[model samples]
Target: MQARDTTALHTAAATQSPEPGKKRDTGVRGTGTQIALARSETPAEGTRHLTGSRILCADLPRTMARFTTGTLSENRAMLIATEVQDLGQEHRGWADEQLTLNPEDFAGESRKALGDRVRALVQEIEPVTALERIDDARSRRFLRLIPTGNMTMRLIGQNPAEHGVLMHQVLSDLADSKTAAGKGQGRTREQIRADEFCGLVTGEQNISPRVEIELVMTDRILFQAEAEPAYLQGYGTIPAAMARQLVRGRDMELKLMRWIRRTGALDLDPRPDLRDPGLPEPGAAH
Candidate 1:
């Protein structure tokens, strides 16, 4: 329905242009269509959806039929569209037909397995195009950071498969070693890996500057055994026990302060005494 609406909007815009013989610009048409769709939050997201819709509708009728019939999800259909995008129209159609001939078979495959199957088919049908796509994708590798709502950020990196696998293996080995050494006590393997990653990236495994962080919690939660959670200013809420561990452990230095709030506003003196003894040694028990 989104694709059909977008196509209709494009045709309408093109036909209603001031100059009878001249068509509206492609960018203008796309912008108008995307705005009319209003299903995506950003222009990039809208463009991606539009591209997938166009490819599925125009080049992969069988896949589109499966998608419409609820056999394939939009994400899976988009995966198929992306895989065949580099192929010529004839080859793209052929790949689509081959993939969707048995809808049940195709739909039952896992997401990763489905992608691998499509890539395999593309390589078999058009090896040169597949290679070209690989080169194109390799050139677009990037690392990005996105801030999620709750005071946390997501770090995403796109690398070649070999490099990614190797990096994961190295992190896993480090985490396993720390676990075996009794230094990773009170932390999960994933948590240990995350600490290792931060240490390596920030050079904190070696000598590093003192870092200060703010932790907010009610006195009941901090002093008593209250079940309330604590908020770590930049990281988000953490369990009360974890917060207590952080304060009691060598990682953070805590100085008590009191604030009075009449309204729902919190104000802290800017120049309140500050102290940072130092963070705990890497792999040290909390």
Candidate 2:
């Protein structure tokens, strides 16, 4: 990776060569020296960038072995190196060994799928670190609402990967509906989803058809108006008020539902559901 970064630097230098009799810019691409410069320039963020770059630098030889011999494509090699770049040196060696020794594992696979596999291996190599990182990330979870001009806004939310996939499945179902496919309406599926999003959030349209949104909350949260939060399955956590309002004045049936975690294990106790005649929650109770 150092060589690759240096090659990039050299290519840029050549492209910007000075005219005759003009002094050229002298820039050193020494590995550690550049990392120090990077840190000084952007103290808060650069250290992380440089450290990641250093890992890739150390792993480049093995990456090139895969690249040069045609066992992995250039992109896949970089993807694997980047995914596990923060792993400990010993674990990184294990990752490299896996890549080289098990070429068939990632051969001819999609980049996204291959990246996932590589990351999973990294988790295997250092499960404790992986879990700590996951918890740290969950602590930083947030949702952003950005308003575009012309009265439109963008909504972005960060959640667990499982919740993300479940949310996508629901929106996709709505976006692909026949009703959403308004004849000669001239709206793209994305635009339809936008409209559907507005409708659903504003209580104008139902979130799902045939299926009801299951609401799971403690009795205290539901009946006593407690400040505690409620679980909304594919939607992750929601405010207790929202969950209460959804069930207020409605006939809801309480049922025992199984709660499953990302690891494919069920919770010890069966989850309690507050299901109205309306749509049941898309996925399992959170």
Q: Candidate 1: count the clashes.
A: 0
lDDT of 1 by residue, 1-286 (tens): 7666655655566566555654557545466446535974566767666667778888999888888888888889888988778788999899988996776786467787787678667666665555466557657989988999898788997764434544576677788778888989899999998888889788777522233446676544444534455555534444455555556552223442323222233233233232122322222333
Tens-place lDDT digits, model 2, residues 23-91: 564432233355446446444333344444445556656766666677766556657767787687888
Global local distance difference test of model 2 = 0.57
Give the runs in model 1 whose Cα sits over 4 Å from its true position.
14-29, 32-37, 144-154, 201-286
Scored against the true structure, residue 219 in model 2 reaches a CA lDDT of: 52
Candidate 2: 10-residue stretch with minimal lDDT:
249-258
For all candidates in order, the CA lDDT equals 0.64, 0.57
Query: Cα RMSD for candidate 2?
Result: 12.6
Q: Give per-residue lDDT, candidate 2, residue 192.
A: 72
